[model samples]
Target: MAIRRGRGVAAINYPTGMNLGGDPTQALVHSTPTGNFMVTLSSVDLGQGMKQIMAQICAETIGVPTDRVVVDTADTDTGPHCMGTFASRGTHRAGNAVIQAAKEARQVMLEVAAEELEVNASDLETDGQGNILVKGAPQKSISIFDVALSAHFKRGRSISGRGMFLIPRSYPEKETGAMKPSTCYAHACTVAEVEVDDETGEVTVLTVKNVFEIGRALNPKMVEQQLVGGSWMGISHALYETTEPYYPNRDHGGTDFNQYLMPGPGDLAETEIIVLERPSGDGPYGAKGPGEMCANPQIPAVANAVFDAVGVRIDTLPITPERILRALKAQAN
Candidate 1:
């Protein structure tokens, strides 16, 4: 994972920008008396739940439950360096890699199966659910478990599996500063409704309705949590939070959290959410990043809500009472 923010080390405020990430191929194998098989990566998942995805894929590759599958992240010391997880790229890249690894491991299993049953690997099938069946004889076939045991005890061979994904992207050839090509992109939209006091410029968010096009809903619960968390953070970032905007005239500072007010418990209002499901192409399992979409609409939505309440619109962020009063006076004239 490579994080190349545009802001310099000395820069105080870094504007929002795109984040990129990648992955490497993961490979593992084990040899038994009967056969050798391997396991591969679907991708690296941390608390975000990529591990679960891998477990499922791994179990399928080895013909076991997700719980039964063992996983190991590609290590730089003993294993190849997998791209560190970031930019929400784990499932897509790593999932593909895991597929590759599983295929390699399956070859060994099929060979062993052919030897035991006296049939070609093509004549045998290992369903993702752990059942292994011969093409013409279901009753004559055995389980992947039986096959694994045979390879371990009888053949005196090993079973191994390997998989990886090298998510492709273009890098700048010259030293000239240019945006790198991104492999995946996520997009969304949200709407909000509210009211404001023209005199006090106090804005009460009536109902914040969020409509977003998630690439694909991987986990509805997790997606909702992302929206909730992001919306809350957006509220603070756009409505109440204040930071000093140093200028040439006032090179020094002001607008500390204590001095610069924000929307607290009393200032808050009702929040409603609506999701617009749209499948994004580059996402994993049709899952786009929902972490920042709600945030994008927060400031604009709150500003519009304030206008509906007080019949005055404040273009700037925060939409403070002072600004509202000033806009109301100007409009009244």
Candidate 2:
């Protein structure tokens, strides 16, 4: 009985957004009388830090601090239309829409502030901290809060804007299946190290080293969290998840957690991630989607690692002890 170790690598290019009629998303931005900004969107966050990233983008675009920006993820009834959250399009699609909305709102804000300050609209700049100042004159400035109040009460104007993002459809060539599925692509490479128990045919994944070109991390901490979580999900899918195995006989299947074969937190492997920030031209502030691509290369990397360790190919999933043992026997014969 010996433990064998091996390493394997995989590279993948994942597209962002779907190819269904130029996936579209919408956003709305408005300023309150108190100078705070509000953003409304129909896209759901799903615990992926969507709200935080969107807020940051809105604040930066409108020349306000992050704290002054409020994100309201309203449902379909009140918010604008969205093409759902899959295809890793939330950040790229929704964020861009928010930027557009903020640009419009900022124009309104600057116009109103210019009227009060008696200066040209183009000569005013935001300090990124809720204050609008004159160009080349830091001392001449007005708080956004005051501008908001005047816009509503004295000027009879409302500071609000709307935006929608749509990726134009790329028609496929008649003879070839050449079509752009998404506006941009996020790239990833994963190398996995694993150990195999020759006697029991059990495999243990030790580490996953990853390099990702995510087109800029809107929230780096959130990106790291998704990468770690997605890696585990990939490992679980590659090794333990099965809906209907042994189709003819269903004796081994269970309807609950106890009966299902899945990896627990105890089975998580060490992950080292290197994020390369290459902004996308079409993305908001050079940002791209990073949610779904983290798990893509891990499955293939693990499969190749198993092949390198034991010199046997288990084409099917889970890489179970029985499958390994059977493959070993076939090799011996």
Candidate 3:
């Protein structure tokens, strides 16, 4: 089965001031400065390739490179008012919203370029590296750099953009929104192989192969990293990471590093991550959300793999040997 976590993951990231159940999902983002055609955003991409994904989205929309675009996610006081980092909504929700806003900001500059080049804004082309070429007259061109300078010096308007959007914008009759359209939906499936010692009742994941469908892999390196890390996280959730709430099953409380037993690098199996290529019409540079989507279906995959290996069904999660043995005994009966 596919990992269907888009809405659930989207809901968890909102802060206390924002209501997940409320109409619109919001972003509290702030742009730093425009060195050239570059702009910044307030999504601190820890490791899920969100930074590169968002940068690609911006560059494609506003006509710049991955390098010409910058993002500043530090400092909560200054950044856009956003739901704190939890659900992997960074690139999907925030990326599209900001890209839409940046396109608005670049509209003014594009108009300036068109006027200077003596052509319609739609007729001009942005080669995505600061170069704007007028149709049929490449010589008659303008750099976004010059446009920025002119916008600042000649027009006397700050070349910056700010925007806010709430996902699933469902509300009362006066509501002015709808479910914020998702740019893309990243999808994944995993296959696991495990070994269970019949005598010791211990199981180890022998191998894990994951295939992910991510729209327009902006940066292959970053996408690979996200898939690998996200697969490992799912593996941990399946094998270890126990969420005990007000229960005394093992005479312990919540699962920290000590209580939890996440697999180390040594414990990790031969992980093969396959990236599916599909261009999303709504995504920025065809990028979709990857992290949470990859995590959703993993537990079921691992459980199915265990059943495949032992010829027994372990319904309860965290397939410990004790349960496997109990299943085995019941099967024998």
- lDDT for 322 (candidate 3): 73
lDDT of 2 at 53: 95
lDDT of 2 by residue, 176-286 (tens): 978777779999999999998889988899999998899989889999999888888778777777766665676676578987767787887898898999999999988
Q: What is the lDDT of residue 70 in candidate 3?
A: 67
The sequence of per-residue lDDT tens digits that candidate 1 reaches over residues 1-333 is 121111001001111123344335455645334322334332355565666655555565566556556556544466544565654555555555665666677777777777788888888886666656787788767666667787778775456666555654445657785754555555544455554544456555545555666566666776677677666656665566545433345543344756666566665546665666666565444555555555667666666556555556677666666777788789889
How much RMSD separates candidate 1 from the native structure? 9.2
- Number of clashes recorded per candidate: 35, 0, 6
Pairs of residues at least 3 apart in sequence or in different chains that clash in candidate 3 = 24-166, 25-166, 25-167, 28-80, 28-81, 29-80
Best by TM-score: 2
Per-candidate TM-scores read 0.65, 0.95, 0.77
Better of 2 and 3 by lDDT: 2
Best by lDDT: 2
- Name the regions of candidate 2 deviating beyond 4 angstroms: 247-254
